[model samples]
Target: MTEVRVGDLAQGFLFRRQAVQLRTELSARGQELSTGRAADLTDRLSGDTARLAALDREVALAATLRRNQAQAANRSAAMQAALGRVQSATEPLATTLRSAAAGGLAGELAAAGSAARGAFEDTVGALNQSTAGRSLFAGAATTGPALAGADAMLDTLRAEIGAETEAAGVAQIVEDWFAPGGGFDSSGYLGADSPASPVPLGGGDQAALDIRADAPALRQVLAASALATLAADAALNLPEDTVRALFDTAAEGLGSAGPQLIGLRADLGAEEARIERAGARIEASAGGARRARASLIEVDGYEAATRMEALSQKLESLYAVTARLSRLTLLETIR
Candidate 1:
């Protein structure tokens, strides 16, 4: 059996080690109380780094998807408003043209011409509309206007139909210019060939972010408007029947385009709905992911505070014991 010594080298070494451990624990607990996160994640997590990394990735992906969904929803809504404007401008002109064709009254024809010019300008402006500095109808050409000016597009059509005497000839010329590889195609359209890419909603979902100004329904509206414009021109010197024929064709074309235009609007509305739903889901998932991440790394406040108090008392006791040991001498110890 051996007697234990109070002020030996072994006792001094044990006290110093205990003091160092207490100080480290106090520092860690203090950090946890202030920051609400584990001071030593590796030790707190039991070295399970892979799970922590996976959780971090989940939170990041959800955040990115939420941002993307918001952008897509805004773009889609803008497209809908732009299309509605175009429809509003073009729709009434059809009824006006039909009235002019039936009556052939000078007053009605004059009103028709003025209305045609206004609609042409408005349609061109609508096609060139932008949202947040991005072209709404330029397909993939997001930075620039989707079409040339109203005067330019009309002038090109007028040049193509130049001096054509008969309705058949004028109609053919209109076809050549408005059809693919024609005058309007060559010089009128200013947008890119490829449309803007779809935006991601979430979970591999995507939404069409734009509608090209050169879409078939829109092209039909422009072409029909051009025909009305030519008939209304005071310079062209078109015969009475020819003017009537042109207006009739324009009115008929617009009537057909109304449904197709509405269909395009419907498509955009559907996409808007999808984006809204995706946004809600992403928000929910993001909240869940964030909570999971906090659970993984955050420390309990009550536990940290209690542990700090205990460590403080232990440190004080170690300090007093060490001080007593340092003061003790060999003579006093032997006595």
Candidate 2:
């Protein structure tokens, strides 16, 4: 039989109970410390890290898209400006041709020819216009001029006047050069199309720059004028009545081309507006994403500090109780 002293029994029981209580309090303190630390550091960091990473990726994507849009916008703007210049140049030439035809002045006819040549040269220059050192009208071949030595070609046409055979040859050259599948086909302002090449300056299922080197309206007017000039100066011998008829036909053709230019310019304006709105939306979305990511990741320092202080106090109290229990003796209990 194990003999137990009453004093030892009381002291042992108290020590066991004290140890149990201390362990319970310590466990509770440990759990509170772990929870507070996790909330302050791990939990917030984990959530924020993922959210911030995702936001960063989104920001990068938006930036890339914005860059592409900016390039497109710059190209579109350059093309529109070129088209505006061409339209302005063509108007006076068309008006002069009309006036020359109305009045049977040989001088006026000559002046019309000179004006046409100038306008054609300007149009060729516009087609070769560039943006950021890249040829705007070169289609996929943006390294060089869309049409090589285009100025020489216009000069050749200008000098080809005053002979029926020569004018016919020049017209054929122009037609073949700007034909639907010719070398200069991709050099035009618009992309390839079967029936007719559309303008390049509009959005929504059409190109964003509607200027075309081979537009039917423009071609018809130019061809009519060139043929008329040839007829008046060559086989027809500048007969007053023949000159009048040729001039009238040329004038009518020029009028037809004018409306198309106006329409194309309007289309360019609308596309620029659309691009602006899209860019704005992308910027706005990026800002919202950044805010959301920040919310996920950032910890509240004040809250974390408060929780740590409370945990420290509880740990101190547990330590004091544990020390007191460890120092207890059987003699003290009996007394």
Candidate 3:
């Protein structure tokens, strides 16, 4: 028979080493139990991190998409509000101009025209509004205001109209200037001609903020506003008939522009709904991805707790043995 002999010092050292190992395992198991995460991720994932990595990436991508979608929603909301402001700015002027024209009251028409000029300035401010430090109606040019100042635009219009006393000629020139590839495009609008790129809202969804200051609807409103301003200009010294003609044209333009601007608001509202749905989808997908990742990486809390209890007991036994060895005396050894 072969006998394996260990000295007291070496035996105690062995027990201490075993206790240290048990303590480390016990601590790891307790952490798993408390945190619900595997202390040994390499073991939990079987050393193949590709699936977990993919899930983590999905979570990150979803977060990014949600952020972008939120920003797009904000931009859309701002545009809707700005459009509403512009509509308010135009509607009252329409009523006023229509009334003045019907009554052929030159004094009332002039007062309304002056009011229209202020409203036009207000409209420009509304369209140039920014949200989150970005222009709401500037298309891709988020950094700058969407349109030139009202004064600048009126100056350009005045230059183009150039002492034209006829309402028909003034209207024609204003329309031409506000048309595509015209003076408004070159100077009045400071935004991009091309619309902004669609924001990705995850799950293959996209939302766009493409409404610009130079839109036809806005152009019509602004053109009408210019006519009203011209009508008010005592500097022009126009006849009552011509002023009435300008008032009628301006009123008509405002009347038609209301529907166009409303249509634009409806389109933006639709996009807002699309973004909201995409956000819901993104959150759902992200939740599923997170749960899937958790399934692989998270510890089974009951199992971890059980293992921790067993390890604790084993460590306690080791400490007891180590203590007994330390307390050994010559009489006790003999006994």
Q: Output the number of the TM-score-best candidate.
A: 3
TM-score of 3: 0.92
Deviation (Å) of 136 in candidate 3: 2.1
**Clashing residue pairs in candidate 3 (N, C-alpha, C atoms within 3 angstroms):** none
Clashing pairs counted in every model: 0, 8, 0
Q: What is the lDDT of residue 298 in candidate 2?
A: 46
Worst 10 residues of 3 by lDDT: 1-10
Q: Is 1 or 3 the stronger prediction by lDDT?
A: 3
Query: How do all models score by TM-score?
Result: 0.84, 0.59, 0.92
Deviating ranges (above 4 Å) for candidate 3: 1-6, 104-107, 300-303
Estimate, for each residue in 190-273, the C-alpha lDDT of model 3 and write its tens digit: 998778788888666789778888889999999898888877777777778888888899989999999999999899899989
Please rank every candidate by lDDT, starting with the best: 3, 1, 2
After superposition, which runs of candidate 2 have C-alpha atoms over 4 Å from their true positions?
1-44, 148-151, 155-212, 215-246, 296-335
On a 0 to 100 scale, what is the lDDT of residue 186 in model 3?
89
TM-score of 2: 0.59
User: Candidates' lDDT values, in order?
Assistant: 0.85, 0.58, 0.86
lDDT of 2 by residue, 1-335 (tens): 54567976687677667666655655544554455333333454754466567787987767766675677678779878987887876777667767777774777777676666566666667767788887665555555664445445444444543343343344465455444565345433343232222322222222354444455544553454444444444333555655565556556656777887677767777877766766676678778876765566443556545655665676567667657766667676587
Alpha-carbon lDDT of model 3: 0.86
Instruction: Write the residue-wise lDDT of candidate 1 on 1-335 in tens digits.
Output: 43456557687788888899999999999999999999999987899978889889988998899888988877888888888888999999999999998976877887787787888788889889887898989988899999999998777777777887576677677766777677776688898888898898778889886678878898888888888888878878788778878888888888998999999999899889999999999999989888988998999999999999999998998898889877777677899
